[model samples]
Target: MNLRQKIATGAITLCSSTLVLFLGTWEGNGQNTVYADKLARGLPTVCKGITKHTSPDPVVVGDYWSDERCAEVEHLVIEKGQLALADCLTNQAIEQNTFDALTSHGHNFGMPSTCASRAVGLINAGRIADGCRALAKAPDGSPVWSYVTDAQGKKKFVPGLYARRLKEAELCAK
Candidate 1:
């Protein structure tokens, strides 16, 4: 059965308990602090996650994500991440660490790409090791390689994404 069907039929249960487990497994590890610092250092622009260039709640000059906002956004990230996994992962059981790592990757990259990713395919095919390895490498033309124009018109790759991907990969391996 499909995920929604499974949920509806009580074959699969996704609830606050699952969310709590996910939250406990996926620590932010001060990612918000790094994100905020990167934003402040760059040109004034608003971003929801790593890739979103614009957001409804735009962070302007002299603005930073408040502690409450940070928490709220992180919660949203985890929720979205879990939803993505639910839709794509066929495996009934997944390692908590793997789930956490994939959640972080999905949070940054979004559902569409994560859903279509080689990592997801391998994981769904029960090739967990291959999937984790595939996830560790950023493919060509990935947003991680995209450039942002600075005030001087010089374009540079977004800060922190590379490191973040590395961390995600490390987490995936565990």
Candidate 2:
């Protein structure tokens, strides 16, 4: 391999590692605290938002996790999420806030859906603020990522999701 190609490969590796780390520390956003599932989804989350979906161990509702345990699980989940999004994330740069925002969104929704979101498109297009805003609301000011369709065949606004999206948008714009 040529020197330039080697350098480029090294740079890409560095960037990918940085992108995987995202906010550096998940606790910076105060999301590391254990949270009981309010939706009765039976998925209580802890450090870096580790839930049953991402946890290797069974995530029980009443289980207590130490800070060390939480951090370990958090790193594991982050790695998993980044791998899941490997092809979806472009070769462009993603700022810390943008990384945090999108990952949180993906955890709440699904990683695949988050990849398909318009926010990802705008972000890849370098319209970062627009992309972040799109996570919370559309141009028409209606909620974008805050509703869930229920078994009753109706869409309902979830206050928790709404708040989380708003927070993500705010952080993403920073």
Candidate 3:
């Protein structure tokens, strides 16, 4: 075969080999029809459990935790009619620079902007509001602040403002 044809053949063979191996492994067990379920749920499974070898970003334990934390709070507000998510997230904001830290850690989705927006959307769409208002305030009576200070010592807290997605949306509407 020509060089190009040989390369194509090799690529196809490698992909099929990987697929066959995956089909025989834990994820591919006949229990849930893994491939079918992935397709149905819109879950990405092109690389299965394989990491950098295939997809550049592989889901990790930390990713799951972030998702779980967010989901748990959302669920509590939406399903249980509980306001604890606000308190839980209040502590989360103060203890962790959650939004910025998550962004710096290459976790864009974990940022409060996105999560807060989603939470609010859920609330507006018949789910509970989840009390994101409380999250924007620091425990020490100061608001959760964000802004750039000028060299002249001008501090701006954008008073009564929220750096959250849902709150931003709400404000924008008004």
Local accuracy of candidate 2 as per-residue lDDT tens digits, 1-174: 332233346532322343334444432334545566545343576655667777897776566777678767767776567556545766356655566577777866778898999888888777888889999998898888888676676778887677778878987788
Candidate 1 collision pairs = none
For model 1, how does the per-residue alpha-carbon lDDT over 60-107 read when each residue is reduced to its tens digit? 554566556655655655565566677788865456566666766665
Worst 10 residues of 2 by lDDT: 11-20
TM-score of each model, paired residue for residue? 0.57, 0.70, 0.20
What lDDT does each candidate get?
Answer: 0.56, 0.67, 0.29
Clashes of 3: 0
What residue pairs are clashing in model 3?
Answer: none
The TM-score between candidate 1 and the true structure equals 0.57
The number of clashing residue pairs in model 1 is 0
Give the clash count for each candidate: 0, 0, 0
Residue 110's lDDT within candidate 3 is 22
- Tens digits of per-residue lDDT for model 3, 39-108: 1223333212222222334423323323334333323222221121222232221211222221211111
